[model samples]
Target: MKLRISHETTYGYDQPIRNLVQSLRLTPSIFEGQKTHDWRIEIPGGIRGPGFRDGAGDWVEGWTLRGPAEEVSVRISGHVETRDTAGVLRGHREMIHPLAYLRSTHATAPDKALREAAMSLETTGDHLELAHGLSALIAAAIAFRPGVTETHTTAAEAFALGQGVCQDHAHALITVARLRELPARYVSGYLHSTADGQAHEAAHAWAEIHVGNLGWVGFDAANRCCPDERYVRLGSGLDASDAAPIRGVAMGTGAERLAIRVQVEEMEQ
Candidate 1:
């Protein structure tokens, strides 16, 4: 399948900022499952700086604004060809050990409820089976609803509330997977809504669990399935914040208001 994507993010401030810097992980991943084409990322009037691929094999680019700027915008557009790899991550070069993802973050940290739930699952011993079970549990536990949670909402909190978006589902799944001693990480990316007709934000997220013999496999508990051609992966990290597509800071104290628009659609062959 071929996919086209467009995304824009704008920042507004009451006061002009003296300086600003950003690191972007907005490019699509390079793996056996997906191939990118004509991808572009633009930040108007910003100076491009050092860029590199991290140990996890995700591209990171830097940008800076030197002037007193009150508004800033980022634009991303691209095309990608993807195929069904059955969720298995292959041909992706990375130096980081899988065990590194066993570390937990604030957003994915489990509480008593999460640990208990992980332990209660019938499947054990097989990492692949346990991962699928955990994903199913998360899909059943949370009803997909936007605006019910915040960016900082923890997996435990979302589990208790029983309502959240893809980010919450990914965090919750990562939490439970870690509780079961599975190496798991959060993935940030885009999703073209499927035939299921369940509307999800174009900016999406999921979890990856390291299964024996299979390496890392993606599971989107929010959609109750593994990633396929409809998905485009960007990056991975221990949590949402760490895996954020954009991360930066302003030198001056100006409260920032952010807005984002994203569209991911299937293109005809």
Candidate 2:
């Protein structure tokens, strides 16, 4: 399957920003089941991007921009060819060790509810089954509500509220898996299908557990299924904050307006 992705993010500010530096993980690397045919990142000032392997062995691009500016927009456009391997990504060759994924960040803590959930699934020995079971549990536990939680919501908070979007679900799953000594990573990308009318324009999130023999297998708790060809993996990290498509700081701020538009469609063979 071939996919074409076009993502544009715009920010309007009441006052101009003096300087800004952004860390972007928007680029995807080719593994056993996927291949990147063409990719490009476009910014207004025409900035250059540097590539490096992160702690989870995922490819990352840290790009920066500076100067007095009123508005900024970052666009990532790419095409990728993917093969469905039944959710298995084999022979992932980055040097980042598996244990590095367990280190927790401020945004992705498990708290009581997630710990309790992990306690229930204590059979052990099989990470894939455990991850699958966890996905079903998360999907059944929370109702998908658009305005229930924001990007900064915690896992325990989301679990208690019983409602959230895909990011909340993935955060909860990653938190719990790390508690159980399993290396889990947060995945940010586009899910090709959705009940919402804009199936082609959606931002999706999921969790991937590192199983020794199987490598990293993705389990989308929101959809309650392993990722197939419909999933386009853009970036991954310990939590959403690390893997966010755009993260930066602005100098001046009175009030700010933000808008995001993403489109992911299957291309003709």
Candidate 3:
């Protein structure tokens, strides 16, 4: 399948910002499951810095805006061809060891409740089955509600609430997987839509676990399935903040507001 993605982010400030620097991980992963056709990142009036593929095999690009500026806009447009690999990440080069992901970050730190939930699960020593079970458990435990949680919500908090969006599910799954001693990390990406080809918002998140022989396999608890051709992986990290598509700081003491719009659609081949 072929997909076209358009993502735009705008920030407005109460007072002019003196300087702004941003790091973007917006490029898609180069792997057997997907191939990039045309991709571009645009920031009007901003200076583009050198971009490189990081240790994790994701492209990292920098941009700077020096100004008494009140607004900043970042836009990304791209096309990719994807194939379904049953969520198995293959042919992607990275230097980090799988064990590095076993260490939990703040967002995925397991609490007493989370630990108990992981310990109580039934497993027959089959890693694959256990991984699937964990995904299913999370999906059943948390009800998908968009406005119930924020970006800063922790896995433990979301688990206790029993409701959240895809980010919550991904974080919770990462927490539980680590509790079981399985290496897991957060995945940031875009999902096309439902199986019936219905239109929906595209930005999405999921968890990837390392099994003994299978490297990293994706599991999206919120969607109750592994990633398929509909998924376009951008990057992976310890948590949402680490894996954020865009991270930056504005040098100013002014209040700021942000607005984002994203669209993903299938293109005729």
Q: lDDT per prediction?
A: 0.92, 0.78, 0.93
Best by TM-score: 3
Q: Report the number of backbone clashes for model 1.
A: 0
Candidate 2 C-alpha RMSD relative to the actual structure: 2.2
Q: On residues 1-269, what C-alpha lDDT tens digit does candidate 1 reach at each position?
A: 89899999999889899988999999999999999999999999998899999999999999998769899999999899999999999999999999999998889888899989988998658889989999999999999999999999999999999999999999999999998889999999988884496654569999999999999999999989999988899999999998999999888787989999998877889
Per residue, candidate 2 scores C-alpha lDDT tens digits across 144-178 of 78798998998888888999998888888888788
Query: Can you rank all candidates by lDDT, best first?
Result: 3, 1, 2
Which candidate, 1 or 3, would have the higher lDDT against the true structure? 3
Give the TM-scores of the predictions, in the order they appear: 0.97, 0.91, 0.98
Clashing pairs in 3: none
- lDDT string for model 3 (1-269, tens) is 99999999999999999999999999999999999977989998899999999888999999999989999999999999999999999999999999999998989988998999888889899888889999999999999999999989999999999999999999999999999999999999998896667775858999999988998999999989999999999999999999999999999999999998889999998
> RMSD for each model, in Å, please?
1.2, 2.2, 1.0
Query: Any runs in candidate 1 off by more than 4 Å, and if so which?
Result: 198-201
Error of 3 at 10 (Å): 0.9
Candidate 1 residue-wise lDDT at 8: 96
Separately for all candidates shown, the number of backbone clashes (residues 3 or more apart, or on different chains) is 0, 0, 0
